[model samples]
Target: MIDGERDLIREMARLTHSPLGHAELVYPWGQGVLSGVSGPRKWQREVLEAIGEHLTGSATRHRPCRIARASGHGIGKSALIAMVVKWALDTCVDTRIILTANTESQLLTKTGPEIAKWANLSITSDWFTATATALSSTRKGHERSWRADLVTWSTSNTEAFAGLHNMGKRIVLVFDEASGINAKVWEVALGALTDADTEIIFLAFGNPTQSTGTFRGLFGKQRDLWNTAQIDSRTVEGTNKAYLGELVATYGLDSDLVRVRVLGQFPSASSMQFIERAVVSAARTREPAPALGTDPVIFGVDCARFGDDHSTLAIRCGRDARSRPWKRWHHMDSMTLAGDIAVEAGRWKPDAIFVDAGNIGAAVIDRLRQLLPDILVSEVWFGSTRVREANWNAGGSGGTRIRVANKRAEMWTNMRHWLESGCIPDHQGLEDDLTGPEYGFDAEQAVMLEKKDHMKARGLASPDDGDALACTFAEPVQPRAVPGWLDPERYGRQRGGSEEGGLYRDLGNG
Candidate 1:
């Protein structure tokens, strides 16, 4: 290496614990990397300074430094992220860095390129090599050990985060666009913080688009553990002022869209989210009501129509939905799913079973009816016109009733109301499914729930589990009368099924 480069590296080693100092010194301000761009913006400078303060002294060295930044659009968050990554990798030796985003496309098209752009323009660019997925040391032996890897998080495959350990060294984990990241991934990533005597820094940056999730918790109940900041686009320099003004004019300043996309604030609930997070959270943690005993046990089966979707079976006994565990199958044939449903029906002897009659759902319903000849298995079409009574008001004070665009909307409306006092299983997937879809009104002002295709287009998973649960509310079912053979007091205990004798035969006309 040249003498100037060598001296620069030595200076960077001195600023190892000073991210702010390192950022200012390593990149040329008026040239290449930051060409025509003054320097780090005010908000960016503050974040870097905070990181430096947290790491500079030995007293706070061992403690993990967590910073959660929720910002409005066009605040140069990606640029700041790039600066941090470069500073961390160049200054700290053998620093293990992992960068992730809400989606793979974000990593590929945005975060990954941002990092490479800054790395190429840095003074020590020759020291590291940037690939499509990683930035590694140019030195042969340090290639694997000293590097930063861009990873895509998955709920099912969290092994990448679970194994994040760099003992006696520095470990930096950054989550870009973190609001969309699943709670399970965040939980798995927490295991990395246990490394003793290591310099740990966890950074989460994103638009506050979600009302509930690990990202939201970083500012809510978990705020004490993190240094959180919310940046409004209007307050930040270089933001599009006219565009922001237009947004405020189009959708009132207090609207959810403006709150999330412009004000860097969490919405009361997601604009399109039919069921609010607070309501779902309450239901998940609620205790079963004593009056639930009289409520009918209903089963909802939603058959998967596509390869990526899941076939789910949800069971609810009145307001108590926690007693029975949900069953989900991926890529399973209709016959197999029907057989499974039949088995659950034989086990629970539900008062009624509502199955989605879309696509291959009809075949599942057919097989289920044949399997449980005596049971009441009903087919429900999601696109069919509303058959139930309209309970919601269509704005204004006229008391005009609101009509649901289809049967799916009607069922979801019922489920949303039921959630206020219902008890449900505490599961993240179920929570995501319930809160995934957005709602809108049609030309006639009829309530229209976002279709599965639209939800997927917005990067949300298909609400299969949610739909199954909603199916349980398709129509009201009368509570089964206590049989003379069975004691009324032991009804709750015997609800699952009878092994000694056939309960299906005994429960007549269910």
Candidate 2:
């Protein structure tokens, strides 16, 4: 080797425990690949400094250096990941680094390319060979031992993560888009931390897309075990301020979209959760507006199919869902539930009654139709794939509509939208029912809710009450015209409606 090259290697080795120093000294800023770029951003510098501190302490302790960062989009996380990978491999001899992401595409297309870019820009670039899937030392005997591999994590195939052991040397594990990584992968990777007297650095970086996951736990339950940071895109320099402003204006500052994409905050619900707990809590405490006397009163009935499930009846009048208390019955036959629904319909004189037409619900709907011939009793199949044209505007871009997978998804989405201004009774069971089901996108990218069976398998009860409430949104209901003889001021009192005067009297008294 040349004398200058040997001097460069010795200088890099001196910065073994100083990641921040290594990053600043090794990379060429404002030249070649990094033209016009000055240095690391403020947050990146802080993270690198934290890593340096952790490594300094590793000499005295056996604990792994755990660092997790949850940040908004477009804040240059890929660049930071590349710097860390380069620093770990270049300074420490026989260092083994495992780089993985939420998906193979992210690892190959985004992260892998970024690492190569930075490695090529580094002063010690000639010491290593970079490839699409791996980077290895070019030294004659250290090719296999001193390396970093880009691995695509899989729940079923966790051998790569399980075999991450390098005794008496450095082991750096990086998880990009960590929020979307499976919990099983995280568990399997923990096995690598048992190598005592070794320098272990574990880094996780991702947008906080999910509320319930290993990533969330790193900031919450397991926070003491790690050094964590949440970086808002707005606070960091070089982010597109105009685009972020547009997002806040479009989705509102507190919306989940803004919270996840701009503020680096976990959503009020999981990313897969259709309804957020914050929205539900707000609805429960909100004061309902006075229902117009002409507003239609609707009844939604969800019949129980199994012995464990409960039959539920939910009543709503315009914004006043809390005016009437919900009715629930366990171990009720379809015939008996139908009879009870018929009696409620007769007493309340609901403008429309929507009944679930799945399994035993079909029998209940049949009995209700026969008993209440004059009333508008309609059958709604939960699995039906038809969505009202007006309800397709929940989420989309460029005027495109977001399609829902089935009638149940449509109803629940409609109910979620309504909760913005509507009022609901504050009940824990109803809260559980509303927030139990997680959502996913189908093959065609249509929004689909988790089936009740899936929720049960996850140890959550069937959302019968939530389904009954959502059933009210099955179809639009026109307001009923007021009688000509009744005075507007005294109409509610005469009909035994709300205390403040509205449609459908508060049924809590009854």
For each candidate in turn, the TM-score is 0.62, 0.61
For candidate 1, the per-residue lDDT at 177 reads 98
Clash pairs detected, candidate 2: 497-505
Instruction: Name model 1 segments beyond 4 Å from true.
Output: 1-3, 32-36, 57-59, 277-386, 393-510
What's model 2's overall lDDT?
Answer: 0.85
TM-score of model number 1: 0.62
Task: Report, for every candidate in turn, its global Cα lDDT versus the true structure.
Answer: 0.85, 0.85
Which digits, one per residue and each the tens of the lDDT, describe model 2 over residues 34-59? 77878888898988888888777736
Candidate 2 local Cα displacement, residue 119, angstroms: 0.5
Tens-digit lDDT track of model 1 for 47-111:
99998998877798888999999988999999899999999888888999999999999998999
**lDDT accuracy of residue 13 in candidate 2:** 79
